[model samples]
Target chain A: MDKTVNQKAWFLVLPVFLVVAFSAVLPLMTVVNYSMQDTFGNNQFFWNGVGWFKELLDPSTDLGGRFLASLGRNLFFSLVILAIEVPLGIVVALSMPRQGWTVAACLVILALPLLIPWNVVGTIWQIFGRPDIGLLGYVLNHIGIDYNYVSNEIDAWVTVIVMDVWHWTSLVALLCYAGLKSIPEAYYQAAQIDGASRWAVFKAIQLPKMNRVLLIAVLLRFMDSFMIYTEPFVVTGGGPGNSTTFVSIELVKIALGQFDLGKAAALSLVYNLIILIVCWIFYTVMTNASAERKPQEGAA
Target chain B: MARIDLVDLAHSYGGNDAPQDSFALKPVTMTWRQGGAYALLGPSGCGKTTLLNVISGIITPSRGKILFDGEDITPLSTQKRNIAQVFQFPVIYDTMTVGQNLAFPLKNRGVPKAEIDKRVAEIGRLLDLEPYLNRKATRLTADAKQKISLGRGLVRSDVAAVLFDEPLTVIDPELKWQLRSKLKALHRELDLTMIYVTHDQTEALTFADTVVVMHDGRVVQSGTPAELFDKPAHTFVGYFIGSPGMNIIPAEVRGREAKVGDHVIALNRSYDKLPDGAKIEIGVRPEFVEVVAPAPGLLSAKIERVDDLGRIRFARARLGDAKLAARAPAGFTSPDGTAGLKFDPSHVHVYADSLLVEGAA
Candidate 1:
């Protein structure tokens, strides 16, 4: 039996395609237009022909130097976020209660930080880290440590990292919790019967089970942290010597503040390409590890 | 191998709040002779798995002790008990090769590497898993995975006994038969005491030397297959053991005679306790109840249906509102409307309140 070639079915898909093209493709083409040419004023453009892209690549120019530094900071922030969150999430997920009303309570509490809007989280932390009235800063200062998140560069970076960790560790924990839940009781029972220790069981059963979800968590955390703008902008306003000004902040500054649309558009493409490449690497490594975990079939 | 003794063991899922009737396993005492093959045959929720779990030390019995060769092992854990169990579903480490899965139990015990390899190879070959030793356990068919599960159990040298909790339930029928035979062969060769739990009667009867039939959390009877077939200790056994269970007809007992509806049937043994309040019945297997021609026999029955089952034929009839099934040889003749169904004197079993009367056949 052969399925009829339903060419008419594409008509149903055409609406979605048209909507995506109008919403995403049109704006992206405008960005591409801005990136390729120099816009001197409103409604007037000069065909620069990759001139802006060339200027954006050179570190000597103001826009290019800011873009490279911000890109480096974005990559570093993403790495730091992942490093703190993944293991911390797994540990938290492991310690979480598996059953009863406590599970609901824990899940709700774990999700509370995630539910608070991003800028709101930044605002909350901003007030919470103030030296005069906030608990953290006041306690740290009284404890004989010079702690001020506003003016201190290291302190500001610590505050951002801590805020990011508090905000997103729940996502990783939730994902890992789901992964841990999917493993059957039989596997644990079998491991127990085989006299496997707790660590052995985690290594053989829990770790392998968590691989796929950890991949998703890593990719999501990386992408979200790389393109982060709202939270840091609300908290520190990209101050303390331009330390926390990531790629998104730099792009916003060039595009909206200085109105350098061409440079910002090119930087946005570079930033998008970086994320795409890194995410592809993450996905490839994770999937390859999973595929490798599957022991080979016999020749017969 | 060690002899397993369950001493006055009982289990209830609920704690102090457990109702009296909620006992999953009613207090029972039994012993399994070392190196003997035994089958715990029962229906679902009959406490067979509970009993197996208790013996495996997975569950501590609410009361009583489990003794292995006269040593109380009830307080020990599963690993301390050193027993192997195959569950209903196959369990193999999906990440490991077949060889690794087989050798896992041994490796966990800190067995010498050379010994582990030898044992793994031997068990793998016996289960016909040698060719797929390097293959991943996850890639195999269900039967092959089940073979790996069984191999895991066999890999351990210090196992007290191997317990199977309906281990073949997941296997295809054809592979079930094959695995059953392989298990039987292993039992014979290794001289290991094995207790198999299953609801299938044929598997129980064929695999076990002694079959302990359980019902409602209590052991109804434990006997050889032949004894269970010939003289079921309880009416439950009589009804549960046979292919088409036993026929139980209400009867009134007096001296050496019994009254079945409107007819008087002679009993081989006299019953003194023939009170009107007591429930009395005659239990007979279809194989034992001989069908005779026409009417004017001891008890006349109206033939409802006759099923020719290749080698054996069953004549189902109604006699005074009591349904009777009698098995006969193939090509047995049946009358048009009515026929005489008589219980063989030696095969007739009398029961009082569902309990078999001793020496009353």
Candidate 2:
């Protein structure tokens, strides 16, 4: 084999670099710039030099308290979403019809919520949770249960969680379904021949085969649920005394509603850093666990 | 551990009302004796896998019963029948260690811990898997994984029969022979009935004591390797079992003579009552016919080329517009175009409509 160093190959990467610089890097640099400066009226700016970061982290000031509370709410919501959706999604995927026209029908129905625009989903849920006009709220109230998302904090939280589950559990179910479908028929036959019970087969074959896809599902649900905004915003408006306010909603309120550019920029940067760190930890832990028993060349 | 019998077994995936030609497996009635090693050899889609699956109780035949040592097991589930099967590709639980994968079947059966450990150790030692006993099964190469699949099948001592469906297909070419011989040795030590299904003749001939050749959803022949070479029961068996397959040329027969296009040949015995208007043909292997100098009282053929295959040489010749192969002796020179061909009378067999014809003395 000939060993040659080709420097011209670097030219081929120029287009992607230019695209990323224009779309992602340049805007991110602007955010970074704003996070370190305090803006005055008429577009005048003064350097703050990490003062906003210190304030956001203090937890005693108003900006720090809001950031910490919203971050806590975001983490709790993500944990609850994972706990309910992952198992429910796997059960739905398992119970789905394996063959026939019913499979197509079920897939189409499962894909319905994912295709709707996010704001539209929020609007639909907002109207659907109104006790005066919506069926769900009207039925719950008529059945002797007090249910109103607009004026009650607990109800607002419940409405947001249930709405999120209804909207996104399908994604997890579809990913697990794809994982299940890729298993060959021979595995099932071999299991039957080995006298393995249904539960045994599930444990030994189906679950192991689904590990990679389940990791993807968990990461996606975690990140998406962490940064959720539109649906809860439309339904509760971070409302009933800020009970359902997640980190994205708080960031929007700080940056747009009060025009606190420096604080909002600092909060957004921290939020991005948290997500990146969490995802990295997730990927590293999972890959290391899967690779613990390393493969080597065989004697034969 | 038990003899298996297929009584009037037949299956048509299309349905019972489907025509005979549509049957995936035609009615097959054969007895596989206890502790006998058998190979089901055929080309792709010849129903070899279907037959093996039927015997293993994976597929319920549309008609007929499967018997295990005189007990009817036709309606039994694969687990209840106590059969084991290894598939073409390895099927191992990725999360389990090598030892755990081998012990899974026993554990599922609720075997005692002491017994499970004993059987797992026995199988591990047999397959040389003891070194990697604690490693995850998924971390091994494909051949090692296949060995794990085989180990799982062999771990259970009371299985009726162990069925292999081309288990060597995923193995490397060099490792195939080693694994194949290992399986043969296991059969010897265990004295268990094993049915190996493969499309490769080499694998079949080297592994089994008796090879059952199938064609077009029917078992064409069942015999030892020597028997299959000396006498093929059907034209397909003749054409399918050899490197350069048997030469089957059309001929006319009467009394003790067989007539090619222009040359008359003598038969060892009289095949006078060959089927009426049936297609008569002569079948002989390349090893039986010798290429010689053109001489009197011998059939003359045009020798096109001679192929030296390390151990033996074969001559491809044209006999009156029909192609045939004959052995070329060492230092045998080809004269301009024609050569004398001498066929051993006892080695030649007559066939009627692709089926062998038994001649009277």
Candidate 3:
């Protein structure tokens, strides 16, 4: 049978196409346009070709150095967050009551931090870490530990890291919790019958079962932490001489604060490229972890 | 291997002060002999799995003790009990190789490395899992995972008893048969005390030397397959054991005679006297009901429907208020709407209330 090709059928997707164009494609196209040009005040523009990109890529230049520093800061923060949160999340999720009214209450409480607006979370913690009036700050100072988030770079980094953890650790915990819940009761019972110890049970059953969800948690946390702006911006304002300025904060400061659209546009594109490349790497590793498995190898 | 004895065992998921009727497993005393293959057969919520859990020490019974060869072990955990159980769904360590999965139990007990490897290899070979020994458990098919689960149970020689709770439930139909036969063969070869729990009668009958039929959280009957078939002690057992089950019809019994709608039926054994308010019933299997030409001695039946099941034709007949199924042998003539049927005297059992009456066949 010969199949008839219908040209008019493409009209059915016109609405979705228009919606995507307006919502996504248009703004990205504007960014792409800005990325390729030099902008002056009063809407004046000059074609720069890849001049901005070249400047953004060079560590010798101030702009390139700042971008690299911000990139390193973002990567380091993400690593620290992951190192602290992943195991902590698993422990919390494991200790969580498997059933009963307590489960609902715990979930609602755990989800509370995630529900807070990012800027509001920052504001809340900014006051929370105040040396004079804040409970945490006052307590830390009274304990004879020098605590100040405003002037000290180390203090500022710690406060920002702690704030991000408080705000987002719930996400990791919840993902791990969902993963833990999905394991069947039979696994636990079988492990018991097999004389598996608590650690053995965790290693053999719980940990492997939580693998997929943990991957999801890591990816989500990595991406979100990489592009994080509002929370740290509101709380720390990239304080202590740019010690906590992640790439997104740097991009915002360059574009709007200094009105250097050309450099900012270049930085933004590079930042986006970094995110895409990192996410692709994560996606590749996770998918390969499953794909590299030999199909029915040694199976009868 | 140990002879597991449940001494007045009872369990209730509901907390203390719960009534007797609320107990998931009612107080019952039973023993599973050493090296015997027994099946706990019942419908869902009939306490089959509950009983299996109790035996494996997964659930501590609220009342009474569990004994293994005369040693009371009620306070012991499943690990302490040295019991191994294969669950309804295969439970395998997904990250481990099949060999590691099988060797887990032995390793946990601090068995020597050489011994663990030897046992793992032995079980792997027995279960036809030798080829998959090095494979990751997650990479195998559903049945292979189940085989690994079964292999884990068998790897430990010191296991007091290996319990199976509907272990074949997750396997595909074709694989279920093969795995079930393998389990039977393993039972014969190892002579381990294996107590299987299932709702399937065929699974119970084929895999076990003794089948314990349960209903409403109580053991209705425990006997060999042939005994349960020929003589179901309880009305529930009669209704539950066979394919179409036993035909139980309300009857009035007085001495050696039984009356159904004023039609007299001969009793093979004598009933000395009747108890007041006894709910008498005559139970007979469909296979034992003989269809004969319309005769004076036979009970008249109206053949409502004949279900042709290839070789044997099953005739569902209306005998007064009762629905009786009678199976015709191969190459037998199909009876018309009106046919006379005789309840095989030797196979017929008289029930008083729901319990089989003493000295009544």
lDDT (C-alpha, whole model) for all candidates: 0.86, 0.91, 0.88
TM-scores of chain A across candidates: 0.89, 0.90, 0.92
lDDT for B174 (candidate 3):
92
Q: How close is candidate 3 to the true structure, as a TM-score?
A: 0.95
DockQ of each: 0.41, 0.52, 0.60
Q: Number of the top candidate by DockQ?
A: 3
What digit string (tens of lDDT, one per residue) describes model 1 on residues B203-243? Answer: 99999999999999999999999999988888889989987
> How would you encode candidate 3's per-residue C-alpha lDDT over B92-170 as one tens digit per residue?
7878899999999998889999999899989988999999899778788878887888788888888779899898887
Please write out the lDDT profile of model 2 over residues B78-107, one tens digit for every residue. 888878899998898888999999999999
Model 1, C-alpha of A75: deviation from truth (Å): 2.1
User: Sort by lDDT, best first: what order?
Assistant: 2, 3, 1
What lDDT would candidate 3 get against the real structure?
0.88
Q: What is the lDDT for B83 in model 1?
A: 86
Which lDDT value does model 1 have at A25? Answer: 100
* Residue B136 displacement (Å), model 1: 2.2
Rank by DockQ, descending? 3, 2, 1
**Runs off by more than 4 Å, candidate 2:** A1-22, A286-300
